[model samples]
Target: MIDPTDFKQGMRRLAAGVSVITTMENGQPHGFVATSVTSVAAEPTPTLLVCVNRNVSCHDVIGASRSFCVNLLAEPELELAKAFSSSAHRHLRFSTHEWRALATGAPALMGALASFDCELAETVSVHSHSIFLGRVVALHLPEGPLHPLIYAGGQFDTLGSRARTL
Candidate 1:
């Protein structure tokens, strides 16, 4: 097997979009920053997946609630990304005015570049994480330019003006 350290280093070379996965349980909100969100299919249904470490506080909340919102962060949401990524800032994760409950009662980021409100359709346990397959029940795409926040090389980065057009 590849050494975990080396595997992490290799993954750092691949840029990933930043997102906040949020859910509400018993009227309380829980969230965590994730870069593992991916679209699985669009034919039979609009489905996406997110991998969450089993140890995160929100892991069980997401499972019990069976619903979540994946909010794709834009450049302006850097602070939000930081807040959700840290356990120390847990209490502040949903303190901002930008959150609202969408169709699934999950907390969605109001001005996010895109918010996928999903119902948990399935869960797959692998190693130390749970891969959640979500069926998109509702979506929100705010009208604006998209300047996505990304993570690579152990830090957050954003696209510069030099990106080449195809």
Candidate 2:
């Protein structure tokens, strides 16, 4: 087995796209910056998963509403990511983003690289976090070439297109 610290460092080397998970509760909107959003399956049904800190406000809102939106952030939205990631006051962070409720009644961020409105399908609590699996009910991809915001080794990065793939 690898040493724990070494394992963590190795995992940190893997780059991940950043996203903001949003939801509304009692007319108040909440969101959090996350790098753990991922597509789980397309067969049977389209689904996505997000792992959230159990103590965060979005976590509670997701649990209560059973719905949420995953907003894939673009490279131009680094400030938005930082704002949502801040622990000072959630309301203030939410104020900066334009939000609208989808059919599922979840708040979806406007002008994202993409947005997926989802219904909470399953959850599993692990130590200090909860893994939420959501089934996609609505989808939107705005007109634009996406330059995704990325995170790796605790730093923000940008994704560039490869000419070889063109």
Residue 65 lDDT in candidate 1: 97
lDDT of 2: 0.86
lDDT string for model 1 (14-81, tens) is: 99999999999999988889999999999799999999999998999999999999999998899888
Candidate models: Cα lDDT each:
0.92, 0.86
Query: Per-residue lDDT tens digits of candidate 2, residues 1-166?
Result: 8898998798889999999998878887778889899899997999999999888877888999899999999888888888888886555666776777777877777778889999999998998899999999998778987788999998888866673257
TM-score leader: 1
What does candidate 1 score on TM? 0.96
Q: RMSD, each candidate, Å?
A: 1.2, 2.2
Question: Where is model 2 poorest over a 10-residue stretch in terms of lDDT?
Answer: 157-166
Q: List the lowest-lDDT window of 10 residues for candidate 1.
A: 157-166
Look at candidate 1 and tell me the lDDT of residue 37.
96
Model 2, position 27, has a per-residue lDDT of 80
Top lDDT prediction, candidate number: 1
